[model samples]
Every structure is written in C-alpha cells, then in structure tokens.
Target: MKKEKIQLKGITWGHTRGFVPMVATAQRYEELHPEIEIVWKKRTLQEFADKSVTDLAMEYDLMVIDHPWTGHAAAQKMVIPFDDFLPETFLEDQRENSVGESYASYNFEGKQWALPIDAATPVAASRPDILQELDVLLPRTFDDLLALAQKGRVGFSLLPIDVLMSFYMFCCSSGEVPCQNDEQVVREETGVRVLKLFKSLADHIDERFYAKNPFKVFEDMTQHDEIAYCPFAYGYSNYSRQGYARKLLHFHDLVALKAGDEPMTSTLGGAGLAVSSQSKHIDVAVDYARFVASPEIQETLYVENGGQPGHLRAWKNTQVNALTANYFVNTLPALERAYLRPRYDGHLHFQDHAGDVVVHYLKNGGDERAVLAELNTMYRESLAWEGVHG
Candidate 1:
C-alpha cells in the first residue's frame, strides 16, 4: 500500500538555542517518515503572540505553544487532547521527574493537553573568573545578591519573563502560591509581594549595563566576560556549547528571598506541542507528537541539535548528560519546582498589566503599594471580563 501523504505545520516562537533540538528532531521525523512533511512556521516570540493560536490553528496541523498558554488554548478549544492517542508506555518511559508530576504544567481540566518539549527555569549564571575576583560565593539569598548588585561589580541581564519569575521566587519564598485552587485565580497579596520584590531588585539593576536580548547577554558573559551574574534561563547550556563561555562560569539555582521561606522557585519556561483540533490528519499528528516526546528523539535531538529535551529519561542519558556536562541534567529537578505564569484567556492583558507594574517600579521607582493595587485591580477586571465572555 502506498503511504498516504501527511503534512504538518509546526510553529515556534523564536530561533534560539533552546529550540534547535526540537527543530532538528522534526527534521529527522520527516526523514524517517517521508510521507509526512513537516513545515516549520517560524516567528519571533512577539510575532507568535500577535498571530495567536486561534489564527494559526486554522493554518497549521501542530503548534509549539508556550506552557502558560495551555490553559487559554484549551479554554478556547483551539487544540485537541492527545491523551487517548499517546501510548501509556511512551509516557511511562519518561523520567519520573521529567514526565509524571512535572507534566502537570501541561494539564488542564483534568486532561493532558500538550507534551513537554523544553522545560527550564531562570538560574544565576556568573563568570567564575569574575566571582573569583570579587571573592564572593554563589549568591544564596536575595539579600546576598543585592549586596553584590550594590558593589557595581555585578552586571544583571533579565528577560521580561525573568522579572516575573523573579517575582514568583519571591512570592514562593514568602510562602505564597501565585495561583489558588487550580481555578486560574492569582492571589493578590502574593502577586503584590512578588511585584514589590522585583521592584526592589530593579532599583539596583544597572539598566545601561544590561543586555536587552538573552542571547546577547550570553554572548557578553562568555565572549567578553562582561557580566558577573545574570538571571538566565536554564537553556543557556546550549549557548555555552557553542564556545561562548569556556566553562568559566556556571548556573546556580535561583535564590530564595529569606532563609526560612519556601525554597527558591523560578518560573517554568518553554513550549509544548499540541495538535490543532481542526486538523484532518489527527492520527499522523498524534504519532509525530509522540515521536517528538520519545526518549530516543529527545536525547539525540538535545545532544546533536542542541534542543533541550523535556523527557526526564532523555535528561538522564549518559551521552546527553555528557554533551553539556550535565548542566540541564543537574538542573531538571530544580526546574520541576518552577512555577508557571498566570494562565487566563486574558493572559496577554494580564502580562501587559503586570509588566507595566514592573516597569513603573523598576524604571521610575514607583511606589510598590500603588503598583500592587493597580495590578490587583487589573487582575480582577481581566478575570471578570473573561468570565463574562465565556
């Protein structure tokens, strides 16, 4: 029997080191299953957001979606559940830490909506030479980090989401969970506290010294050794392999706010693959999703193509662990502890409001209380609007 032609459109937000492995894996899949043609819909993260899954689902068979958007995508019924199609053995084969409970980030309404592709968290990456010169230990607490920041010797670089993850770390350290009751409700006090801590850090951040893009920051740290410490996504290991930094610095788990508070928690960062409900080729799409999730593909992709595999087993592979010197392998357990951002249908609006709060306080030294109040109001209004719309 002739193989039926299967075409899949996969979307990725950016062409970054973090995504190289998955993209390579897709290419390999095409080679193995020649009948199935996979076309990548490449876009910057911002462009991906602007295009929206609702629009893309109409055009694509598969989508690589951000984890925070899982809830919103399911709420909109833009993607279909692959739970029934995904084999139990494939799911069972994943590393315990990588797939089982950690997979909860991809679950919505008691159903598995997507498969983890790349899992990460913000960690402190510093130049070993710089730290040696400063005679400072890897920062253990926010206060220790702040002291270093005050010395004018430490240069900090952060992504917009890094600011939020920093906030999550603070809130979790303060014994707070951003979401309550699994109903997509953010605790106002937790949000406020997180925001306030972020603002405090912003006061010390030397804006002029920081790099605007993450890759640039990695380059600065590795090439020029310009930055001493940065809150970088764990995926930096891929960049490190490119000979940007010569093992001069390493990643330290995110710092906690206080000694007795909850352990330091960073935000869960990365994307997942989901099939569009509108696709006619559901079986082929499901097979491709599982293939990408497989341990062999995950391990090979990460080791050869620089993709960060979301499977725990892939993370534990001797070859893969050796590839990047167990950077991500050492960090996966920590990444599992990371929190996710607010996932509402109005997530974009909430992110904008929260980002504004961060900018106001960080850039202009705005009052934390007032900013918190404004954020709380925005959260409430957005949730209400979502409820009415639903």
Candidate 2:
C-alpha cells in the first residue's frame, strides 16, 4: 500500500551549519514516520539576519530564527509559543542543558518562542600553516592581537552589523557593559574608549574589511594567503573540520582584553527552530522541531552533519570532540559566557540603524561624543517606539 505523505516547507540560513542539520533530521524523521515529509530552503546569512520573522512565517510552516526576534515574535504573534505543544519536561531539560543564554534568549514575556538548535558567537580563527610560516604565535591578549593586526596578518568582519557587535565587545572589554540601563546604552567614558578602540583597529587594517561579513572573511581565508588570522568572528565548526574547505581553519577563544584575564564576551548568536502561527500542519512542525533539538540526535547525527548543537550534552560528547579536532571543547567556554543582546519589542529598530552610526564614526574620523549621543538618542527612541507599537 502506498502511504499518503504530507509535505512541509521550512527556511534556514544558507550555510553548511545552518542548512544540513534540518535536512538530516527531517530525513530521519520521515524514515520513522512515512506519512510526513519536510522540505527545507535557505537564504543567505545576511538575509536570514535581516529578514523579519513575521514576514517569513506567512510563507513557511517552519523557520530557523535569531534569538533577538523573540520580542518581535511575541508582540506580533508570528510564531507558536512552544509551551503547549512541547512537553513541560522537555522544555525544562532544554533550559537546564542550554549553552549559556541560548535557551533563555528565546523565552520572552514568559512565552517560549522557539527551540534553539544552533549555538555560536564570535571567536578567533587562524590558519596554522600561515602562522608558522610567518614565525608568529597565536595571541593571548588584546595588545598581542593589535600587534598582529598591525602586521597585516589579521582580518575580520567589519560590516555595519559586525561593527556594532564589535563595539559591544569593546564596551565589555573595557569594563563598561552596554544596555545595562534604561537611560542609555553605555556610560559616556566607556563609549568614547570603545569608539577609539574600534577606530584604531580600523585604521590599521585594510579598508576592505569594513565591507566584509564573517562568512566572506572565512571564504577569503580559505582561498587566499593574504590574511593569516582573524582575531574574532562567529565560529563555524565546519571550517575546522578536515576536507570541509580548501583550507581548514583552527578556531579558539578570543584574546583577553585589557579589562581582565578572561576573554571579552562576544555577542550571543544562534538560530532556533519554530513552528509558524499560520501553519496548518502545526502538529507535524512541532514534532519535527523536537526531533531536531533532542540531545541524543543533536550529539550524534546533527554534529556529524556540520551543525553546531545548542545542547550541552552534545558539546561534552567525546565523539563530537574527536570529529572536529575538539572544536566544541575549545570554544565552549566562550559560548557559555557569551553576552546577550536586548530583546525588547522595539530593540530591532535601534539595532537596524545603530550600525550605521558606529560605522560612520569608524570610517570618518569624528567626535565620538556625538556618536554616543546619537546612540543614546536612538536607545531612548526605541524604548518609546516599543510603547506606541506595544
């Protein structure tokens, strides 16, 4: 007898880490339950970061989303809150085993908007062959990194959004964490130093860096020998594996900053799997999400296929360690202590525009005081935007 199969569509970022796990999980789930089939599509990483979940929800039954969208998803009611469909025990397990704030980042206004399936943040990457050739050692301090960048052996993503993230890192590195108060994003003195630090790096590196994203930087590293190291970029474990790229990258935690012995906290980034509010096949979508996020499946199948697992168990698994040359073990400290972004309802608008303000100050030498004032104004405005939009 021929089984009647129902097809479902999903959207994820167009990267090896973003696309493979979903397809692998869907294929396994279909083998177990022949009546369902899931087809996943992908958009560029930039599009995935820039596109609104509400707009994507209307077209697809499922979506892999950024954690920052939790507030927007809740305000717009674009995705199903997972509490009802997923068992309470399952949700609790996820929270207990989450890598840092990966689980909490998706829980907004006490509603679970999505299941985190991938966990990542900015970390250092280098070509060991290039490093050895240059007779340079891996950096362990911010001063060491700056020296390396000065030698033209360093490169990183400094695109608009990347610049904003780097500013956040600089703030934390200097002992002035941002978004700590309702009045302003950061203390004025700290904001000034952050800008100066960013500009100092920009001045030393090539202008081309300001236009590239992390993925592009990694792609360039693999194809050329111009840049030997990247001090910080979102870690893609796939690039560290054998035969994954033209050249394999070695990833580790970032250099320690002037503020402390610990490395500066990178902004948290990872995608969550969610069922759309408008989906007719809600039951199937939820089941598929659960299948993808399960610790056992995540540790074994998902990691094998190039996905970075959010589950703590997978991160600690010995087999997972062996495959990627201990990539997870090396970067876990960075992920567990990563900094989280603001998830307020109107935070998106502020983030969308704040990048340009920082980039302008970085490119054109200007009054950093004005930049801080502009950011503070944007922060206050975003809060008000939330009130009216709420």
Candidate 3:
C-alpha cells in the first residue's frame, strides 16, 4: 500500500526555454519519486524581470527568480535561505563551479537565497547564412560594429531595460563602471559618450528593435532575411540549438571594445530557483531544486530540454557544445567577465524607473546633460530607501 503523493507548485518565466525545461524536469522527478509531484506556472519574461519576489513568494512554493531580488528578499525574510537547507559542502561545490558569478549572485547579506539553474549574459548572435548572403564579415571591434550598423543589418534589443544595460556596458568600456557607489551611477562624460554611441547605432538599425526583447529579436531574425547580427542581447541557448527555431543562430562573444583583446563585457542576466519561505513543503522543494541544479542533471536533461545551465561543467562539456553549436564554450568568456548589478534593497526601485529615462532619451531627443542629472538624482533617492521605511 502507498500513501497519496504531495503536490507542489512553482512560478517561472513563460518562454519556450524558460517554461519547458522545468516542466520536463518535474515530470522526470515525479517519475522517479512516486511520492511527490510538482507543477509550474509562468509569467512573461518582462514580468519575470519586474515582479516583486515578496509578493510571488506568498503564492508559489517555488520561484524562478532574478538575482537582484536577493537583497530585498533577504531583508524581508520573504524566501528561504539556501544556506539553511543545503549543506556547506554542497554549497562550496556550487561556489567553486559557478559559471561566472552565478553562484555568488544569489548570495546577499551573507546568505544564499537561491540555486542558480541558468547562467547567461549578453553575447553576439548572428545568422551566418544571412551575413554571407550579404557579403558582410562579422564585426571584431567597436569601430567595426558601428561600421556594420551603418550597413543597416545589425539589430539588438532596444527595450528600456536593455538600453539601460547597454548604457552600463558602454560606460564600463569607457573606463567607468555604473553605480560603483550609493551616491552615483556613472561619470558624466561616460554617460554622454554611451548615450551618444547608442543614438548613433539606433540611427542605422530598424526602429522596430526599440520594442523587441532578446527573444523577439531572435524570432524576427529567423523569420526574416534582413538582420544579420546582434552585438549584444542576453544570450538564449535555444537559438543555437537545432530545430528550436525557424533557423539556427550562432552564439559567440561580443565584438571587442578595441583591437585584439577580450570581447566587450555586458550585464549579467540569468535565473535561479528559490523556495518561498511561506511554503509548507520546504523539504520537498529543496530536494527538487537540488536535483534540478546538480551538474549531471544540468548537462544532460536540462540542456536536452532547452535549459541554459549555470554549472561550469555543463559549459565545458563537449557533448553539450556539440548539441548547441559551441554556444556555451564560445560565450563562456563573456559570462565569466560579465558585470554584476547593484544589490541594494532599493536598487529595483531605481531599475524600474531609471531605464525609462534612458529609453526616452534614446527614442526622442533629450539633452545628455539632463539625462545624467536625472540618473544621479535617482541614485541618491534610492540610497535613502536603505534607512527609511516604506
């Protein structure tokens, strides 16, 4: 005789890559453990980026979360700290093998809030067949990228969040990092240069990119014959895999900021699995999360089911690369050097509004001096939330 199975629910982003792998893994986990069953629900990718984890934790036993939320979640005690449930030995292993700062990103206020299941950053994506048809060589330097943009084939996600991230990228490449301290976001000169560069590139590419997210950009590229390359958008491994789209797109690092060196760095973006502190099924949820993130499961079942893994072993696995057209290996360097966003409890408030300031400037003409002043004001106001109550 057997007892009735336990049921658990989860929330994750809703995309073929975002939603499918978790469902597939849950099916297998249930098959192996007849005592438990897990169901996953989804919100849009933009919502995934924008939602409040404190609110989501109340509704779902498990959550797929962005790393930036750890600060607020930790402060509010809205989610279970992985360090409390997962063993130190296991944690040390995760820390040692993290793809870029994937493992560390989840650690805030000296506690681990989630298990990194996917690791990605902006990298170059191109349709070689289309580029070859147009007789344009892929770009290698910032100057080359601008030259190619002038040819009217390059496109990248120009959504506000992405524009903000691109601003950070150009700011970093210009020798000043954004939000280095609580009081400021970027140097004035660097902000001006980054905005000017973005406007210059936007001048050449189709205006439709302003509305496209990374997934949409990939979809449009596969559906049409016009765009040939994207210098930076969050990498989606599915495009590199066969039969996942209308056409396979090759993934590689970004064009260099200068001649003969590492490719330009971009903002880090990935998803992790976290257990809601409110869940009655903590043990079961933790077990499933551990199972989903283990290297063996990550390299084989997760990748096979369309997940981009956060484990370094998966990135280095030859078979994984063979299946995904070397997307992991070629883009690994960029991820390893990717820039991390600020984790202050009030950072999200800034992110939600600050991006639009840049986007507005990009689309409609605005004074660069005004934009810089606005960002600095937002930065100072956000830091005040550190001590003030809601």
- Lowest summed-lDDT stretch of 10 residues in model 3? 381-390
Residue 188 lDDT in candidate 2 = 90
TM-score, one value per model: 0.87, 0.97, 0.97
Each candidate: what lDDT?
Answer: 0.67, 0.89, 0.89
How close is each model in CA RMSD to the real structure? 3.2, 1.4, 1.3
Candidate 1: residue 82 lDDT (0-100):
70
lDDT tens string, model 2, 1-390? 986789899999998899998899889999998889899999998888789999999999999999888899999998999998999999999999999899999999898999989999898898999999989898888788888889898899878888888888888777777898889999998998889987887777788887788878988898888788898898898988899889988889888876358887888888899899999899999998998999989999899998999999998999898888788889998888788989888998888899999989878989989999999999999999999996
Residue lDDT tens for model 1, 1-390: 987777777777665544566567778888898888877767775564446777778888888877667767778888887777776666555435463244677777877778886666666677767888878887777788788777765555454544555565666656776655433334666656666666666677668633344545556667675567775444466654535355445666666677654447666776678899999998888888888877777777645776766787776777776776567656665676776666667665666556545665677765666766676677677777668753
Q: Which pairs of residues have clashing backbones in candidate 3?
A: none
For model 2, where is the 10-residue window of minimal lDDT? 256-265
Model 3, which residues run further than 4 Å from truth?
none
Worst 10 residues of 1 by lDDT: 93-102
lDDT value for candidate 2? 0.89
Tell me which of candidates 1 and 3 scores higher on TM-score.
Answer: 3
